[model samples]
Target: MGIPLLENRTSPAGARPAERARRRRYALLAAGTAAMLFAVGGRWDVPLAAWLFPVLLLRFTRTTGPWAGTLWIWAAHIAAAAFWVYESALGSGPVVLAGAAALSAVQAVPFLLDRLLSARLGRWTAPLVFPAAVAATEFLITLLSPFGTAYGSLAVTQHGDLPLLQVTSVTGCYGIGFLIAWSAAAVNGFWQEPSRPSARPAAACAAVLAAVALAGGARLALLPHDGRTVRIAGVSPARTVAAAGRAALARIPGGRQGIAAAPPAAVDPATTAAQDDLLAATRREATAGARIVVWPENAVPAQAAREPAVIAAARAEARRSRVYLDIGIAVYDTTGPAFGRDETVLLGPDGAVLWTYQKAHPIPGSETYKPGDGRVPVVATPYGRIANVICYDADFPAMMRVRADIMLVPSHDWREYGRPHTDKAGLRAVEGGYALVRQDADGVSAAFDGRGRVLATADSFGADRQTLVADVPVRGATTPYDRIGDLFAWLCLATVPLLAALATARSRRR
Candidate 1:
């Protein structure tokens, strides 16, 4: 016998208004529960997001219209992204949740678009719109406001898939994002018996990832740290940044004791000796043919090229010691901050000033500065082709900028964040295909490889730090980031608007 037919209509033509209201209420409640989970993303969690997908997929597939279920899902997708944004900005709070809810409202455009696209393209194409548009919007928004990670991005969900992540080495993170999403799309499309699911595309993608991982792993496994022991030094001498003029005067070496404005030429014996000692040791190592000698971000407060005295002294030391020096010196454009920003410079052998990358991005409330529009000059040396940046600038994926083999991230981490800074910086290394050199004053000054593994770690900052010189392999291949440059994101961007237009036309047509 058939079950109770609540969905059955008493009237032959249609349900009565009161019955319709009752059914509508039931639908609304179901929508609300789905909406809440989508907002909170409980489905992706231990018992939630993962299970949610299949059920929702079925709901979508079985619905009368191709786009029937997506509006609700997109609403959830956006809600989660906004929550992440709030979490990043104001920290976690009820207000953040509120912001997330409001932000979730931004889903209307995509939802309308998804429905139209689904109706037109039919089955599964609509689903792809969600990830593609989401990625696009995330990329665009990041261009406008540098707030929060792309938390709603599905890329992070595949974080554990080492081989899958290998695509990052060539195309950056977005390739993996597209792959995982497309994999989900394929799985969703074929799992229902009418269509045969070919695992080949997914398998091929996975295989390529695995091969890259194996190759990278093999290289790292065989590589060694700076094999010989050397007494490397890191200094964090306090210098009040109140007055640039006074600071320059204070550079008169021992003249710092005088507490008087002194000539740039005036020299203090002890302070001079200390700086000279730094130079002397650097020179000694270089003379001893040391591979690399590193210093903290802004090792010397002044820009080298612009400052004759600083340059003269560094060259003297470089020439005297013949050591390849990598010190983070603030490149001051005295006439005016070039692009109104100070930059970090890497002085190579013979004081040739091999690599000088102006920071491509700046942090808000940034005591830090921006680089010039001229060039992001990457230098070549036996150590590696290098892309060097200072402190906070490292957070940006370096999208829209030139690529590099090794990134010299000269940092000065503060007390608020310590070792985690090093770990987070490793993200750049992972995505960029290099072991980054993170040398900071008050934190975990360490080295990490392209795989986000810390090849070497440092002691707490400010403890007469020792230099960590490692013999990293010089690589020339493009990373996934280099090739794609936010591929998935751009795809999303294109899909969203196109979907919207189609939905608009369809609405008018109907």
Candidate 2:
């Protein structure tokens, strides 16, 4: 007879290995959550560079222990999302978790789905499979909700890829996002240990590199620099104080007068008119025989049809100066399908309406302002065909689809840290192979050519008034992005069927 030995056990007071294991699991989950939250809120400017998303997820997901990787990775996403929820839930004004929290949940879906595949699928295909799933998730669901925003999307990593960004003008930003996610996923595959099963991962990494080289070719083919004369306008009809009060008043659905409330701050009687006059001077500087005159958002508050005096002056200026007015003014759509208090307008050189782009994106402080459902149509004139995107519309990748040789962004940013917005917008112009004209209020008003190079810039931030004039080139070549819109996103989406095939093949072999 042989004696049997019992397994070792810890006493109630002792630190057990299981306890430490549990703590590790909890820590991974926490990391995943933190990553998601940070990416979603735009709180961190250099989010990916500071904390590479793929490496973080891979560390948590590629663990050897059973069920450990999934928990840790999921934790990483959830913890990150919670940061966004907690900040908003505790902030000033009313507490709300509707958009921010829901968006966080939406982001977490990919991690949960990825883990399910990662468990059964061989590590060989991690690069191809993982990026595909992520890209698809971003694309298919990007337009899922009525207000789904890719504002903090994973593709933002390509912020440094000026040439690659041009692809968005043709296909849209979602396509660019696909490649970026794939690159990160492929990178993680290379770092995962246990080399015998890492072949497919290497292949995935190859795919990313190949795609980047292809993008480089397209960028090289497009002429990146051109010097074209572009006249821009910067109009400010009201002073800071009057504009503030008027902005507050502009919010309520109105008939120009009889708002039952007072402005946010009293208009400073000393300098309101002086500020408007200063804007007039800047407008003159911008329109002196420039190819196209630019305008600021909400430069004139009066309804377009009702402003005979304002229209007469603008019309006379365009005809006499022989300069086209792309001036931003408020227009009414009393009987239109939708009702908005104000819209951005474009007046022609012949003293007629060339095109009018209603503000598509509405932000806080604008009263009863509804979004303009339609995209801005590209207008062809003697100067060139131009696509007019107003204010918040620049953030959307879909807006890049409208056909135009050049882009005109009319914006007003009195708020500080407006340079990032300008930089991002300017990048979009470069990515799409078009000259970008921006008329800004206290911002980086700029012009960029088709190859994503800056032509001219009014580098003065928070200035009293400024205008930038330079030659705006009209480029015609469509980028690969235009031809292959969101192929990366589509590849990501196809992961669902791919995993099924892998499982079936495994069963058959068995």
TM-score of each: 0.60, 0.76
Residue-level error in angstroms, candidate 2, position 350: 2.3
Off by over 4 Å in 1: 1-121, 142-161, 177-289, 302-306, 331-341, 355-357, 368-370, 398-403, 415-435, 450-453, 459-466, 479-489, 498-510
Tell me the TM-score of model 1. Answer: 0.60
Count: clashes, candidate 2: 30
**What tens digits encode model 1's per-residue C-alpha lDDT throughout 1-510?**
243475463563477776675555446436544443433312232223432443343334334243434555555555455544433343445545554554454433433443345445435344565446545544543455443233333344444344445555555545544544444444434443333334443455456546766765665466433432322223333233212333554555432123222332342332343345457557555555565666666555442333456556776666566655666554433332332234554666677776655555554434435544635567776656676666656655644244665666767655435454455456566676665777776566776556665556665443443455554545634565766666646666777667667666766777
Tens-place lDDT digits, model 2, residues 18-134:
766666645654564555555543334454542356555655555434355554454454555455334423232222334444554555555555555555666655455555665
